[model samples]
Target chain A: MVPNREPVTGRRVQFMISCLCDAFFDDAARAAMDCLERAGCAVTCPSDQTCCGQPAYTSGDWDAYRQVVRHVAHVFHGDEPIVVASGSCATAMFHEAPIAFEGQADLPEIRRLASRTWELTDFLVNGLGVRAWSGRLPARIAVHDGCHTRGTPTIRAVRALLGGIDGLEVLAFPDQDQCCGFGGVFSISHPHISAAMGRQKVDNVRSVSPDFVVSADLSCLMHQQGIAGRQNREYPVRYVAQVLRDAAGGPA
Target chain B: MSRQALDAFAAGIESEVLEAIEIGARSGVDKRLATLTEDYADADALRRLAGQVRQHTLDHLDEYLASAEERLTSHGAQVHFAASPDRALEMILDIVRASGTRVITKSKSMASEELDLTRRLTEEGFEPVETDLGEFVVQLDGDRPSHIVKPIIHKNRRDVARSFERCGLGDYDDDPETITRRARAYMRDKFLDARVTMTGANFISAESGRVAVVTNEGNARFGLAAADVHIVLAGIDKVIPRDRDLALLLSLLIRSATGQRITSYVELVAGPRLADRPSGPREMHVIFLDANRSSVVGSDMAPILRCIRCGACMNACPVYRLSSGHAYRGVYPGPMGAVLGPLLAGNEGFAAVADLARASTFCGACRDVCPVDIPIPDLLARLRARSVREGVILARAGVPSMAGYLLLARHPRLWRLAMGLGRVLDWLPLRRLPLASIRAWFDSRTLPRWRGAQFRKDVKRGRREQEDG
Candidate 1:
């Protein structure tokens, strides 16, 4: 494990924009980059990078999973810290990729990447040592910890970052630790059960009735928001990057 | 036996059943955490120690099985080995047929559920009565147990009352205390009249050959004491190396299962009645059922054999809590069942229940709550890979498309082109496109119009602005 580094300005970091964020919510992706830049990091998006192979891996298609992860490892090969926008995708790269290439000759490179990788919130709070934001946002928000981030350091980082913003009332709802059921391939394969879980999570969110629902992983929020939308209800979900950036007086 | 089974169960499940399951499962999770944290100063360390003990036993299981057989045989108990469920049923049937009476009483046992013991016994013209209160209700209603520990978790008091009334045990009464009194009175008669008793061993010690059965109801003790023959049917995975190991194993089991310091009855039977003993079974038979467990012992699925059947995983699982156990379409349900079902089906039968592996959201809740720390999500993923290798048709119709997506992902240019194409096709009715997964997504959620790689464009533009400045 790499020891914690001192708070260095202009820390060169490679940003691995998750494919989900790139396609569905590009503005949020841009917001993530802005937040990183605001925290004094020089961010570079690897142009050839596309995904972390989580969808293929979680679906049990190892052939496809290995191929995509191998391509990603080559694309993001560097000594700099790798920041990911989604916790699940970060877990796929940092945790799953190395295990997938356990005995292969590329194991060293996979291990190196895994060692330097960080989820965006973890990088912002731990890597840069940014505690309190420069601006404020007065809105009640419910934070959804993605399943991959649950019981991980990323959750604590999420809480610290969200709690740092001035005037943001961070609320936790019932069964907050439960998954939103957007488990990559699971949402597609077991749609009915997935929707049922999502509906339950949305109900929990409604119980709290926060002004906005924010999550570190947009995949979960996407599923929850979709379920809410289906029922003609407005969930008003936002990515953590968007929340932090907008709260810190960065670009909307 | 595929996703169709899961779909049918989910679609047909009553709202009342779902509510009952969620409420029951949530309370189980809450009580388990509360007890573990409050009772044990270092609960996690104990759990880890128990896991190591179980893993060690599985590692040297051949030796322990032999030792256990030798110990039990020397204690004057006849020991039988069954390689399959059919052979187990045959041995059990043979024992019961010669017991001099038609009535057999049984305690709550998941192993029996695996064998469908009661149904088979009914087919063979011998009466097998479920003695445990929950199991009795399940038997009377002809419903499969949805949760391992709580047999009727999916059923409410009304369902139990209706089933009880229909079975002529009593009239329609939904009172919880009334139900318990009627069940206790009813089982008392069965226990007295039963000539043969069958019980499942929670843990069988190789050192002492003692079969430890823990129950809150104390039904196993009563049934075994009154019966002429006590037949123990246990899976080979239940054997541990020493009697002392039960201290930690039992603690983990009870705490994880029911949040109790100890069950009301911990019946430890070494052998049958001797000249010194007054009221125990005259003849005792221990049947160690392999039922494909031997093949699983040294395989990649070996870790799952350490499970203590606590049902903590099911209680923590979001998918299981929502879909209920019946959706799993097997005796085992929840995250544990997702891995166990496919592996137990053997390679030839893998295709039938392969979809169970995909039933989880990989939330890691089950793994966290598991007493033995079985990596259920990883096992589920392993099963999925096995399914892919064996060419089993999965509920995931998106498999082929996923392959195509990977192909596009491998080539950055094609991926960029697809992203751009997605924007153009955003207005098209892709939801009506006949793809099941796509239709499923569109049914509940709508995606925003694609920004055509806006992040990538912004990063490049930012670099240009920086260089120029």
Candidate 2:
């Protein structure tokens, strides 16, 4: 637990880069690393990680789901609290992993691992207990609540982080609470519906007329960005990490 | 159905469905119910108890069904069993033919919609009148209902005016009162003339053999009151163990569906009109339609049987709210429809309906808002898995690719190798790559790009810095 008690690595915490995070949202990973480490926890990127089997589990391939769960469980198999960049992946691991590995001998450990999981913003605010953010960016931002994170503790944490920032005004539309239709493989599986939903989200963002749209889950942001890109609109989507890390500068 | 439905879905999701859903949701403010549910201390307790009652009834359905039949017989109401839609239709048609009544007046029932009873009656030369205002508009326009509770939620007064004008009902009016009055005036003669009134049961109590029906329009009571022969249709699982249990269910059902303190009418009919009654149907017929429910009655998808036909899941669902009900192209649309649509259709027979299982994003919104707490997403996922297993339709990505992807995910080394290859694709123009799945997925999506060293290799530098520090 105290491995990073040394002067320079003093404030760092281990970051469990989700499979998708490691592969695609590398900027988000580095940003999360910067903000989290700067917030006084050393960032430990668990390298041996694969997916949390969210796609497979949601698809009903429980057999394949368990293999990935067990493998990921074994990799992050410690007391180090696993921080996820995507709320969906976080919920998948913490909430659903045990259900996936249900009635099995390895369930106890999976449950134990689930207990230690935390989404990035939730960790930044609740875990670190560092309020009054130093991250400053003078721009109005629209907050897109991801599909899985709605009405969860994660929403409050994301709001808290945005509110804590210096000069960052969070603008949300009336219909901002709807899903962007990024249901894991759903964006691809039901691309037409997905894009339509994403366009709806983009329109909501447009109503607010914000400089950028920010979300904890990069997948949702990417889906919205895709629609914006296709329509040749100026609404850019940014990971909450990128915004928070850029604004806060170092630490509050 | 699913193929065309998918096409409709592609078209409608981009159209004014979003505006229609928003307008309906805005006007249909669910805050009162949310507040009442929060204020009502036993809301959770009541839901659990009602769920238990429904489960108990389904568990001992045969005994209850027998009890209902026996008790209803004593009250002069005949009970019939329909094992399929065809049987149900045939049995009802024969009864109507026996009564020498070709005209039927119907109250809005999802069961009737499921049976496509209206079209059947119309085709067989029985004049069927849809009495509910929403259903009436839907009927006049020659369209299927887009929502369960508010069937014409997709239509405005202008649309209604246009529909009425098109149907030559003689008025082009956007006034609410005028529209209601006109509909009432038109339906008055049909209700008075129809000899048989057919309605769906909300709950059937075996103890008293009484059938309870809830409606906002008050047309249900009128239909039952006017007709000499009352024909009540319900799914077999709609039966409850006792009469008093209806109170607990009504509390949940009333508020959850449309957020009302209570609907305008909650009528319970047991048997037929006795000599003491002022105005009641002289002869009553109750038909419990199985319609392949026996298959789902004891299977893994059995939890769906507990549904009270409340449209809470549909209202709360983001996908459903945007696309409306018609996009589902099923009798029961939205989350509930999406779950049960394929189940009742027989996963083996219907390809279009089977594709409905894939329509959802599997968001947990529907699950969180359910009154009986039917795990809709779980059921949807289970159905999706069942679809994959049955090969009803290879989920956009064929099973072979899913299998290959799963195989790679299970192995860290293979996953890393694949990620490296994917990273190389990321470096190249993704469109130039010949990977069909990737290209198809990124067709509407800008393929995500990764930066810096792979996390597996990059983590060492952090550890090395930690050691040096």
Candidate 3:
């Protein structure tokens, strides 16, 4: 009963649809599924998913992080690799999950899960070597490199995939790696600094003068979009999956 | 000075600092943190070591204080323990009274700022001069420091030149060396003629009972050596376990602060005068001021005592770079200052600077650059929570508006409708808000636009269609 399953063309793969994407941003997850399946890959959505424990780890709450990591590791315990849609979630799995179970006997399982985890773009570019999408969209797009993605190797892969799309003019932002300042609850807790950092990011996007700002993480996009609406500004925001899907003549 | 005067000075500094950070960001100076963090091993190890040392010093502060005093007295230096700021001031006044001293020169000391010592000295008919170049500029201009390390960082060379001319120091030139030499000539006579010299201790080694002073300029050495009486003022927390601890701190201090291996001079003074030395102070007095630091000691906030006053956090702070130190309206400024000010002053209003705590991007740059590895952001969060609990926020209208917004945000249906309407209204010309009303929002950048489709709605529709298929 896999939803949005086109025939698996190239290879069979598994994915963990992040809770945010499953419940709130289902369209983006579906768009990504359509793109991946059309490009010949079987996708699986794990049902026992909750959160990546980023919220807990970031807050310095080690106890909450321990519980979340234990649950996530057990749910995705198979030998086959698991892919995630959100850059932030994937980053948490790879970076923080191992650190959470540092001295426990279950450390090996946590380490294995960390190694096997990948963001969607990482899976596509590194796992499948599908650099160019067989789809096309024409628009001037500004790409925001999520803070977790900037220093990692996967950002280059995402850039490579975007570059391979014909007629897609990818504009560069000044401080592209700077956090959108939407650090989970950070925005609400310290609104002034969060707003200041967001304004800086928005200004960077304006300088590039793109039709829409795109990123892999929907949380950042949501924050930037909300600020844009409240302030009555005019540059739209979207996820890279939606942009890539639209370019492929699929639903945005 | 009155609180009103201080507030005006702080507001002016805040504006200047904000302008500077914006300029730095535009010029791309903020990108250095990434490479800098990579160069240092995870500072967690150093942070833990510093924390443990500070806790030990603070828990047994009385014992350490007695030990430090006994050792200093044995080495021919007098020890004075000031239980309060008034007692500290009276002790210095008593020395002035006994010696009939009318002129004094000082090296940069936050303790002097804490006691408002200069103002008190002047009121009592004694002239106190600031000999540090940055301190001299601020003294000449009659302005408080805009930063702890770079007191006049907000002031351009032209401002210094004008200040110099106003001081009757002859014509003003904006060159750095020229300004320095001008201050030097003015302070040289004061240094030589000074009846007493006062300085702040960087670190007091309990093992050796030697006070360590690290300075770029030789003002501390000159002031202490040339004066007839030398006085050292320090907080109780400034005492560390041993010289090795001082060495570790000194190594981290210079490198983290100005990116230097060490300052020009590292002076370790154990007594009044050295027999082998050609010249030195005749009488040495050490004042260990407790004030409110005892309250911080052995408490959750004690880790802040690990600070060596290196000003590394100030240099790395984007907010400090923008607002400078004056905006904080405290003796200290920057990330460390934001935490230290309220605790020392014993006034909740001083905690208003925690408003600036909301100014950081939580980029972790300050914590990363911190040689001692103070969990600055975590401390900031605690301060913000404290501010909310005290009801000081009600005094500011901004907090209520934020609270209202948060209430609306909690309701999903209302939030979505408001966002939908906001998207439509944003396209209308009348909907554009005044830049000043939302100046804080648009100061560095414009707002992004609301794209037409609701992401949640689109996602739900996609899910429903797939389910039907």
Tens-digit per-residue lDDT, B1-469, candidate 1: 2233575568678889999999999998998999999988988788778888998999999999999999999887999999988899999988988887788999998888889999999899988899889999988988899899999999999999999899998899999999999999988888899999999999999998999999999899999889999999999999999999999999889999988889999999999998776668999999998877888888777889999999999999988877899888887899888888877777677798997888778889998888987878878888887787677775444443476888789999998888777786578797788777677777877666677787777778888998999
Better of 1 and 2 by DockQ: 1
Prediction RMSDs, each to the true structure: 2.8, 4.9, 8.3
Which scores higher on lDDT, 1 or 3?
1
Give fnat, all candidates.
0.65, 0.42, 0.04
| Candidate 3 deviation (Cα RMSD) | 8.3
TM-score of chain A of each: 0.93, 0.90, 0.89
DockQ, candidate 2, vs. native dimer: 0.35
For model 3, how does the per-residue alpha-carbon lDDT over A51-154 read when each residue is reduced to its tens digit? 67666555444455667777777767776656778887887788666655667788887887887777777777766667656457778999887765643556
Tell me how large the interface RMSD of candidate 3 is.
8.5
TM-score of chain A of 1: 0.93
Off by over 4 Å in 3: A1-252, B1-63, B274-279, B347-356, B394-396, B400-469
Question: Candidate 2, residues A1-252: lDDT per residue as tens digits?
Answer: 001111222344557777666777777777888778777785666666777788887766777788888888788765767788888888777767766666689888887777777788877766677554666789898888776775357788777777767788888686676777777666655556667777878888898788888888887887777777767787677888898888856545
Candidate 2 Cα lDDT to native: 0.76
Q: DockQ numbers for every candidate?
A: 0.59, 0.35, 0.11
Query: Which 10-residue window in model 3 chain A sums to the lowest lDDT?
Result: A1-10
Give lDDT tens digits, candidate 3, residues B332-422: 8878887787677666454455454444444555665566666676566455545554654422223222333333323435544554565
The per-prediction i-RMS, to one decimal, reads: 1.9, 3.1, 8.5
